[model samples]
Target: MPSHRPRRLVAALVACSAALLLAACAPTVALNPAADANDPRCADVIVHLPDTVADKTKRETNAQATGAWGDPAVVLLRCGVAPIGPTAKPCITVNGIDWVLENDPASPSLRYITFGRIPATEVVIAHGKNGVTDAAVLPALADAIGAIPQQKQQKCLDTSDVTSPTGTPTAAPPATSTPTPTPTPTN
Candidate 1:
């Protein structure tokens, strides 16, 4: 038989080339490591990240404790960030996880910082004509983020908790599925 060894070598080389091509097709996203990116709690969150978010496949990210999804990276998640303090921004609970919305003036992205979870997790989601909404993104991440234990003292309280001078309770705000923002570019 003619040089069967040479044929085997050629087949191996072809398979390697195909793998390299596929790897090159998916670019690794660049991101900055959070303040406590090495926190053990963050590892818990990373391990639970879903393979897909809002119908987009997860992509590789360069930074530790960070994740990106979508071919163009419409959703970016960073864990082990500085925990957020009390803020006047809107706080919403999804799947038992509380997230404080970071309102960016005139920006097309909805940034959410975990409210009571230590070694905080932050998720920046592109929302607009070209991107998915918070309704789709937050719920998808709830299980992954729920890994970080919430501090009992810092729970999110709604208007229902407020009382007037006569001790009469105020009506709770109508529950919204997600925070609504005007459509704009994420850049």
Candidate 2:
């Protein structure tokens, strides 16, 4: 009985060791600190994070400033970035927050950095063979990022109607349409 007990204990120890090793191998994300790392707003955003994004589950991140989704990390998010100013780049408002997307096709995957948030966010989508696009993931994070109160002057460009010399709102001329001519008499 004593000999059998030692064998059982040894087996249990080996099993525990294997489990720990596997746990250690689980995915971990490496993230760079953003310019707004110490901003109070970041804390509010981090706690509201959903368990998943873009249908991919959120994985453990190495730092408070980073978030990662998917096994190979198809979608990565980092909050509290330096605010971006107006540029020639295209800007689109998503879920009420304006976003400036910068695409670098030269890289293996497309990386989209958020434009207008005071504490901007960075979303990286791996252009793997799977062909995953940022559109698949960006929406999931929009509202959460929008919750961080934007400093309009610093974080966003006013997208209001362009002013005219008289300071009146620019209105397009009424659209006109010509009635189609009747061909029934010819037929």
Predicted structure 2: lDDT: 0.72
lDDT of 2 by residue, 1-187 (tens): 2568888999999999999999889868777777786677777777767778777788888776678888877887788877667675656666666677677556666656666566777777776675466666767777677767766554444446435476768899977797778777663
lDDT of each: 0.92, 0.72
Clashing pairs in 2: 100-115
CA lDDT for candidate 1: 0.92
Q: How many residue pairs clash in each candidate?
A: 0, 1
Candidate 2's clash total is 1
Cα error, candidate 2, residue 104 (Å):
3.7
User: What is the clash count of model 1?
Assistant: 0
